[model samples]
Target: MTARTFQATNPATGQPLAPAFPVTTPQEMEALVAAARGAARAFAASTPTQRADFLNAAAAAIEARADAFVEAAMAEAGLPEPRLRGEVGRTANQLRLFAGVAADGSWVDARIDHADPARKPPKPDVRSLRVPLGPVAVFGASNFPLAFSVAGGDTASALAAGCPVVVKAHPAHPATSKLAAEAIRAAAQQCGLPAGVFGIVYEDGHELGVQLVQHPDIHAVGFTGSRAGGLALVAAAQAREVPIPVYAEMSSVNPSVFTAAALEANGAALAKGLAASISGSGGQLCTQPGLLFVPVGEAGDAFLNDVAAKLDATPACTLLTGGILNAFQKGAAGHLKAAGVQPLTQGAKPDSGAQPQLLSVPIAQFTPELADEVFGPLSVAVRYDRLEEVTPLLAGLEGQLTATLHATDAELDGLADLLHVMGTRAGRLVLNGFPTGVEVGHAMVHGGPFPATSDGGASTSVGSRAITRFARLRAYQDFPDRALPPELQEANPYGIWRLVDGERTR
Candidate 1:
């Protein structure tokens, strides 16, 4: 039987791109999983330096082919050249960041305790360290084809943690994913790693994704997409005989609050910034501020008017797919019909692209549907009589990736309770700024509670700590020092950081 094939569509032109990709067959999916499982032990046994070399090599390979990646992403994603180019660099940096983590060898978090012979109940020598969780399955995201897709953070962190990775190429940008996979395979080959150390499967539907998650050999899964998609993968993983962890980054409205004092101080600037943040990238960002809380008064009204003016001037940009545009239109229309919701500004509607929209509603009339993510250049401003009223409303919101507060220094001093509530509701809190830009670093928290991520905000899909999701802790009690992993050995052959007798040491 002939396998069905699919091609990428240029969202800007509504035309199909060349070189259709065939969906992975059931047999092929089984083989890919088997290969990854077969290579797991060898890959896990590899030295941290070896994995680091592979990661660095992969980053370099991607840099060498950066232009090609940006071009393909622009056509398939409808993103501008500069943004796509920056994404290419950001993707490479993510790989290199994990490379540094691998080379350091300290991320394993080794710990040791010496035997105490003097005690009646002698304490035996005990040591522990993190080890790879074997093969991982990754799902590329539609919005971030490079940074969150094949060879993206999830793949980088998993491989850095000494786990083999098999990625399901995102259907939106198969060509770009293929290019990234090629670079990673080349890096694996160059580093003398197994052929199964990295693999990618092409598919346009969810069947292969479900199969990949359910594959017995896949020890963990990494995903970044919608709430429905993340939950689906989470459910599938749980249904397995031995369920694995799914680190899925899903939906977030990323609410922002503006105090009256702050708005009075810089209403126009805040308005401009909010407008840019909302419409940027056609509002596809996970951290896009979908909801805003503004005090009902002259200042708030002026701020909303300025924001509407800015959005009205902003041009309509093509969304990632026709389906996304349609959904955005439907969502916007739904908001307009909701009780007390009024359209603040509506940008010129392009035949194929999304029209930027800003809607306003009173806090009392804010429906749950209004709080839901519309997934395009659309946002809602909820009016409140006083700042205190916003606390209860914010408490009612679902877990968010970020919660931002725009307030003056004096105002912030009085907002302790509000800030505390924001902390509980979101993984990250932004003061006097927007939430669209997520910094990738050691201290960054990209994951959030509940629907924002599947792990109840326990894990992050970005930064150095992301490697921990693909690893498990193991303890050795009274084992020969020579038999222990280098990171956990008495001699500390890796020369990495460790906790010795409850004290941090080398």
Candidate 2:
């Protein structure tokens, strides 16, 4: 089929975001894959230092074009300037972080086992090294245009691991994706990398996403989106004869439980924080706390009242897309009308946009299915009679990226057993703070259980650990010096940490 044109409409103003662009035709798609596969061969052969330099150049390009991307993203996504600017910083920071990891040369996990000539029989010398997984298909996320879209974490990490990338740009922020892609393309040219080392595909339909994932030459897939979408892609890849791993960060509730002591101590303040977390970015984060557990009493009602009041005052703003807005409204209405549920407060509907809202349901009626993330500025407060009531309820959680607790040291100690149990349900456990500000550091774990991510141990785009996901280990058995990869050779040129004979050292 001939490719159809796709236009990005501004979420804030309901106007055309920019000029529409035609989707890549199947013929063009084939050529794109061919070029990416060719580039993968060259990129995969580059030294770690060389790849690091290219990544540094890409980060520089992003910094140079930051203003343009921010404007485009703000217009299309209805995100305020402050949030957009921060996201841009995070995006650039991610690229630079990957650059440092690549330059360090330790992500390769070099391991060497010297010859064991005196063994029964003969134990030959063995060495192991990590290598890139070749061309990767990166699916851009709707919410994070810069950090998870064109020049997003998947693209940055894949490049850091010396793998070529073919990105399927999200339609929600097409203009922003295009601008970031331009910067990356310019960086590739300046760095003397192959043209197809970074390819961008603008597709409004799911066919291109399917094609990109199912492409025989693509070695792996990286995705950040909904549970349904991520799972569908995984199934498609598995249907292939040579199944490739799809690292998809999908749905999460990011449940937060307030101990009775915390709730009774500072229910009002906690309610305010919850309001902002639920309403920020129109509640568009995967880590947004959807299920809030509080003790049922006058205190619970007081906390809910404060949250309702804050939400009532929150100004209604446009959602990222009309489709999202529709879904949000439908969901908000559904929860409000659901049995044993009540609306605490509703924001004044902006003359032009949807408003923020808070809804609550009794524990008996708030089933696990109702806890599905609504993807808008809405929250469901579930009241419990005691802390014991929370354990069984939380035990039903499928998977999550974070579980937050607001409690004093003594209270946390009392609930230590519960915290330990909840730890298994999430990748990160937080105390007193909302799970919105995801730090980009060595210790951060952004991916969690089955629904949070296909691989719970997978790192988000933020940390140095993300570099490992794109590389695979290969063991060398009694091979000649020439057969050994340069990274695993006895003479180590790129000085970085290694596990020599399974002992960690530099």
List model 1 lDDT by residue over 77-175, tens digit each.
999998988898898899999999999999999999988989889889999989999999999999999999998999999999999999999998999
**Cα-lDDT of candidate 1:** 0.91
Quote model 2's TM-score. Answer: 0.95
What do the candidate models score in CA lDDT, each in turn? Answer: 0.91, 0.83
**Cα distance off (Å), candidate 1, residue 319:** 0.5
Q: Show model 2 residue runs off by greater than 4 Å.
A: 1-3, 347-353, 456-461
Off by over 4 Å in 1: 348-353
The all-Cα superposition gives candidate 2 an RMSD in Å to the true structure of 2.1
Number of the top candidate by TM-score? Answer: 1
C-alpha lDDT (0 to 100) for residue 390 of candidate 2 = 84
Across residues 1-506, which tens digit of lDDT does each residue of candidate 2 receive?
Answer: 55579888888778885588888887787888899888987898888788888888888888888889888888888899899889888888888888888888888888888888999888788888789998899999988888888898889989999888989999888888888888889888988999989888888879988988889988899999888899999999999889998999998888888777787888878988898998888788888887888778887788888888887888885788888888777766666667887767755222223676766777778776677877777777887877888888888888899999888787766787779868889889999989987888777888888888987645664578777788898898898877677777767767777787778877
TM-score, model 1 to reference: 0.98
